[model samples]
Target: MTDSAASPIDRPSFGIALILVGMLAISINDMLIKQLSGGYPLHQMVFTRSAIGIAFGLVIVQFEGGWQILKTRRPGLHAFRGLLVVIANMSYFAALAVLPLADATALFFAAPLFITLMSIPVLKEKVGPFRLGAVLVGFIGVVIMQRPWASPEDLGVSRLVLVLPVVSAITYAGMQIMTRKLGMSSKPSALAVYIQTMFLLVAGLFWIFAGDGRFAEGTDNESLIFLLRAWVWPEGVDLWLFIGLGFNSAAVAYCLSAAYRSADAAIIAPFEYTGLLLAVFWGWAIWGEIPGLEVKIGIVLIMGSGLFVFLRERQRNRPLASDPPRGTGATRR
Candidate 1:
């Protein structure tokens, strides 16, 4: 009998482990951001984080292929992808300032559904009824999570602020699609460098225009404060925390890239749901906030539907025991 321990199926288990660890690290990053959002401008935080992140990416590039790995033929795609990430980052972090962590995370989980729908048009991938139904169910979960019928959750924040995470999800999905498309020919480290550079540029521009003076007004609006806050010098502890986030950012970028590269996306995608559990834990532990029963139900629905989509795709890809032909799956169309 063959040694199952070394079987090909087991290879992806390592990838799954990397992904889980990455998610946990990222959750810690979010927790820190949530804590600091009240005190610092989002752009300043991003500027600090990206400066360190760029250093980290360059180190990896040096070890991977020594600067040559940074070369790419599709600079425009890289720039566009980086811009999407910046938008997603700003939107989600802005929501973090006002929304409960778990709520923001649950709503952001809709990215997979968005990706599924976007792939049809962008990648020209076929989607069957099962996957489509899963996407619809996932969206319903988003609506429930909003709890619009109830009183406003975040100091009666504007509906526009509440919608930020959903916007983040959409842009995040676009970034993921671009990542998949570029994965065909681009180096992952190069992609990281591009995104980090974009963050640096965005952070600089934000500081230039809004770093001081009248743009810093309106601190009274809780929802807008995170964005409009001036670039104050981060205090000692917060300074250290901001510096640490750079390492966190690089770890997240590298681990996520490594995970997807190691396994079929169908196998790795479901692991993204782990972010919900971590979010819940951090929210309760750090802020004494528990998601209401309705939000919990919404989380279950979103996670279940996303898992179903992955499982369904896996089933479609699996070869049947009785089938002899290997290339006849409808999903291939």
Candidate 2:
């Protein structure tokens, strides 16, 4: 986390590029996780990914400032942030196991909307009419995807299960908020390492207590089947894939942290939607999972709302000739 006080040079274009690259890495990570979720326990996959990610985090932390990076006055905040991320990851991967990739990604995009709402209380930030309207539009998109007004037959059993991704998005928003709070106090590598540590602990506990032996021979629910599935000895190929996924995860985390630190978040944040394009591409390429018409509509509404919010922020924060210094405006930091 870079200090906000020591202003960095404005580089919104470069920050946007970094965010796009990060989202691409994240999409690759999701593809690998979805591929492995078929045969492996979610916990086991998390354990493997986090174990390798911790190694990457260590190298990054060392490069940043060696052991001095570990010195933070806010261990409790880091731990809470770590817990939020662990829960977010669990909920997200669980939904990914059952839903189409594009559909899941669409729901997760609500995180930004959630962040906008959460900021009112958490950061004491004032929300003007434009942002409020964007938030409402975003939730309308969520309801469209949920389709609670539909008949029971149309709703299907998956309707209830699909809520997991929404939960994931909310928790992810909270995690992002916490990241902003701690951004000035901790190193980005330290935050990454903390979350990886929590992942290892959570996954290890799940493996020990919820291993395959505890479940019946057959399970019908896709989400549960993915969650409670027993860990197995990874074959050589799966082992290699797990290793690749860890590095991919590290790249995503570092690039995202760097992007936000480099320029105004409003400028860089819209590019995060690049993940949806990659999600659609990978979903079609790998699984032939084209989103249905209703889902496509929902995706558009959510994305459109998010883009509108970003446009409003950019306008609100635009620099004026009367403004004092280059670093004082919203666009600068």
Candidate 3:
């Protein structure tokens, strides 16, 4: 499929609204996952959530264009994209088990910066020096949040665990770039089904290997425990929360895929910062996790740099572009 065969009209405003909604849903999903981290293993939660998500995604498929829309000439790309999402989710959620919601979210917001940098090499787009500098400032924010100079006890998190969200950000950047590529030829609902299915497959593999919790024994690492812990049957409110995750996952996948597919990524990417605000609010209200002065400064720098990049891209009228795939259409802005 070609760009002309996909969406001919780019609706950036609509994309922004969708991304805001997606970010909101994502924040709620993170809170639920964190709340359940103590009692449930990550794979089990992923399994339950994905199973439910697949059911919802299939329903979306019917509304989209039926099961036919799910057929693609790019199965390999979809598979690769799914793997990237699974990696991104596992790493970020693992960090959530050990870090404050605000802190983990702040670190993960580095995805926009990674997206900007990756655009140059991966998409063959040109980035100006000013935008490059903004990327640098964003890294400084990540460093301040990490606080390498502080001891583990002083920081209240092991430095080793700090790497997880960064890993998540990098893989997520890669995944979103693929989303842009795949979005040119696929429906958002179809893209979402691929992701949910991947999550289910990975969760099943984890169940087969580590669901017994044998590997988690004698380990005090909270992040590892979250990954390797035995699966317990969820009861009462916990079951409802798991069900909620399914709805959240389906919403997030569709909204984000549609948002990126509909506009220049630079145009809508900054809207994702909304998640940070939601995370901070949820952290304080639910877990009593408050951002320190340094964390506040770091967040400011990160968000500031990202907004600057967005403004610069808009000012230059230089949205990232991919090589045209055979057929001609309106050039993406």
Candidate 4:
């Protein structure tokens, strides 16, 4: 018998395998950003990622059908989304520099709460007290994680480092709200393409004026002037830098989008957070980065409460979820 025929379990196995690999890919991509951010400009790093992301988006559009998606016309919300990305990318990248990937990502998990809150004003969707309480509970976890007014949990604090996670939560939450509103008029392919395109354009423009459009200063260090002769472009081997980022990102996009389609939000939604565990492991191994007890405790609380919030929301929305596809990254449409 053929292998496929012999191993009937292989059908579902492929999906499970892809999901696992995708999480790893995303974690590694974040690791790359953290490593590169030490030297590269945040604007330039985002520019390069956006440039690469759009290329990937183009390939996807071609596979799906091209100009049809390109033909979309919602310049206003599209522009607004570009602005939101400025906040998301900068805040998230800045947070990644010091915060463990897991911590930064946990803060991102609060994006759903942001979504729920913004829906009233932007989407005009009314949320009852139950969902509102869930949002509050989720934010309580966020505050616990933030540990404002000082907590016994903090290992050490410069104050700035501790606050970034909370800021990341708010910014990412804003990003989700923007995506959801924009998705109403934008095609998935179109939305992805435009966001990347706009970010690339905006960051590129900023870099041009900031550093004469070269994306590298004299030594290429824009993050600080302290590192003399700091900037250096990739050699032959380093060109693979962008390629590596692109591959991991594409894999993440595919897996995450597919996961949402395959199962319920509560079931698979929490699965994406698996990237955080991998992040913690890799961070310790590669960077010797160890978060404090409070951060570690906060990670548990943030993820646990976030998952609880998702589950609670699912229970409330359960009746409507009859074969309903879970949230793909683009909640806009």
Best by TM-score: 3
Candidates arranged by TM-score, highest first: 3, 2, 1, 4
Model 2 CA deviation exceeding 4 Å by range: 1-9, 151-157, 181-184, 216-218, 318-333
- The TM-score of candidate 3 is 0.92
Instruction: Give the per-residue lDDT digits (tens) of candidate 2, residues 195-228.
Output: 7888889999998888863672577887888889
Worst 10 residues of 3 by lDDT: 324-333
Clashing pairs in 4: 183-332, 183-333, 219-231
Candidate 2: 10-residue stretch with minimal lDDT: 324-333
Error in Å for residue 182 of model 4: 6.0
Clashing pairs in 3: none
What does the lDDT read for residue 101 in candidate 1? 92
lDDT agreement with native, every candidate: 0.74, 0.75, 0.81, 0.58
- The order by descending lDDT is 3, 2, 1, 4
- Model 2 earns a TM-score of 0.89
Per-residue lDDT value at 81 in model 4 = 58
Worst 10 residues of 1 by lDDT: 324-333
Better of 1 and 2 by TM-score: 2
**Could you give candidate 4's per-residue lDDT for residues 1-333 as a string of tens digits?**
100101111233444555677778877877887877665555666666677777887788676456565664556655675566566656666667666666677676666676667667876776677667767766776676676767535534345555555565566566656655543333334556766777777766666566443433454223232112123465575568867776665556556544444444455555656776887888889888786665577667666655665676677775111112232243210
Candidate 4 wrong stretches, greater than 4 Å: 1-22, 120-137, 149-158, 179-187, 212-231, 254-267, 318-328, 331-333
Write model 3 residue lDDT over 1-333, tens digit each, in one string: 211256454798988898899989999999999999999999999999889888998998899778888777777876787898799999999999999999999998888788778877777777778888999999999999889889877987778789999999989777766655544456777778888888999999999999999999999999999999999999999999999998988888888767866776657766878999999999999999899987898899999998888778777776543222211111100
How well does each candidate superpose onto the true structure, as a TM-score? 0.88, 0.89, 0.92, 0.75
Winner on lDDT between 1 and 3 is 3
